[model samples]
Target: EHGRGPCDCAEFLVTLVERLTQRIERHWNGIDDLADDLEEAVLDEAGPEVGATLVDLRRQAIILRRYLQPQRDALRALQTGQPAWLESDDQRHLAEELDALERVVEDADAMRERMALVRDELNGQASERLNRNMYLLSILSAVFLPLGFLTGLFGINVAGLPGTGEPLAFWIFVGALVIVAALQLAVLRRMRWI
Candidate 1:
């Protein structure tokens, strides 16, 4: 036995990387839930970082994937009697965990997809509301169009007009406008178009 702590051997980096990979597997699964929550803002804690948290989860998942390759290879080498001491059961557990973490990757993918869909839906709803508001405003403006046209045409004509030559012209003109307005309202009501 070289007796310098098995990892202190020439394969230290390889061993360390492998061990890190196993640990990474554990946290990988946690990332999945984090991503789901981030995407849905399912929990309020995610706050403004919801998107950023999902992005981070994806980034971590990718990193974990890269580590898993070398980790599995290292484990295989150990299994083939390459390591000075390979605890099969522990390694098996680590491998199982690694396998489980793969699901996390899949879940994160699903989460991002759902989040994108939700964002699009929210945008569509907002756009629809905006369009409806614009339409109503335009309709109201259209309804007032006649008033504007009537005021502009008769307002600037102070001379040579039917009402400009008579003493009771102003009263008669007002009376005529009231009758016209009443008739317009009655017609609108009859047509159920008011």
Candidate 2:
């Protein structure tokens, strides 16, 4: 009804590219926010969920870049090729769109890199925590190993265990175990393992 012709195609394309660029910019901002959250989550030890969110964000960034690159390239070509149908004004508008697209693509790439760094930091923290936990467990096992052995030796129902006949043997054995634990702790402290 408006009697628009093929010459208007350039205007339509420009508008479409502008809308797409805006959407991509919004996505970039969201990814930026997520990156910030990931850093905070890492510091708080927020666990596997943060990792999953990072993975999703990385995937989104990759997909955005993947799509945006071709659009940017097409826009560049459209501006340079200058099809006979496109007026100088159309070419100018397309050039502006191309610039916007290029910026958004760069933003996507930068966001991906930022997410990668966050992932590495998260992995480092998790590894450190695991190592610390293992160290504590090893120390506990060392302290208990001798105590366990003593109990096992006395528990055997074989011939005359000297403590078996004495009413105070159990108390003595308990005291002995406590002393052993205390000694182990002292040794650990001296070695600075604690």
Candidate 3:
């Protein structure tokens, strides 16, 4: 009851808007830091935690946009409507706050885009790593399959297996196995599988 007028109320609202703008600026800075963290995590080939962090960053950006978009629209409407109670000075102050809000919104949008790019890069790196590991496993399996078959065959209790009784037979079989391995390696190298 201090006899405040309509202009006083408008001034108070402007002050509140200014404070909100300042807070949003701080929020935008926090988002910037998060984005930097995400980039570093990607470069370091961070694990699932990076994905979770990216999700959190995106969620924060979405929430910020959710609140900001409407506030921006209202400010625009106020500026365009120019109510009789809002003095010219109040309108100017609101315009400045609106500009600040717009810049923060743009920064948030850019940060989101950057996060998306980092996520794609992380996925690509993971997929490439998986493919390389699978290729190595396949090569190992290829190299070992014949060796396993030879060992199993020689271990069988069948009679009349060639060179079974000779004193050099074991060494000869070993030599044969080494030859087979060399041949397989040659073929694999020719095919560029290694």
TM-score of each: 0.53, 0.90, 0.89
| Per-residue alpha-carbon lDDT of candidate 2 for residues 81-140, written as tens digits (9 for 90 to 100) | 889988898888888888888888888888889888988988898999999999999999
For 1-194, candidate 3 gives per-residue lDDT tens digits of: 67753447789889889999998998789888989988998999888889989988988888898889999999999999999989999999999999999988888788789889998998999999999999999988888899989989998999999888899999999998899888998999999998
Clashes of 3: 0
Q: Who is ahead in TM-score, 1 or 3?
A: 3
Q: Of 1 and 2, which scores higher on TM-score? A: 2
Cα lDDT of model 1 by residue, 112-154, tens digit: 5665664554456557778989977765565556666776777
| Number of clashes recorded per candidate | 0, 0, 0
lDDT-best of 1 and 2: 2
lDDT of 1: 0.58
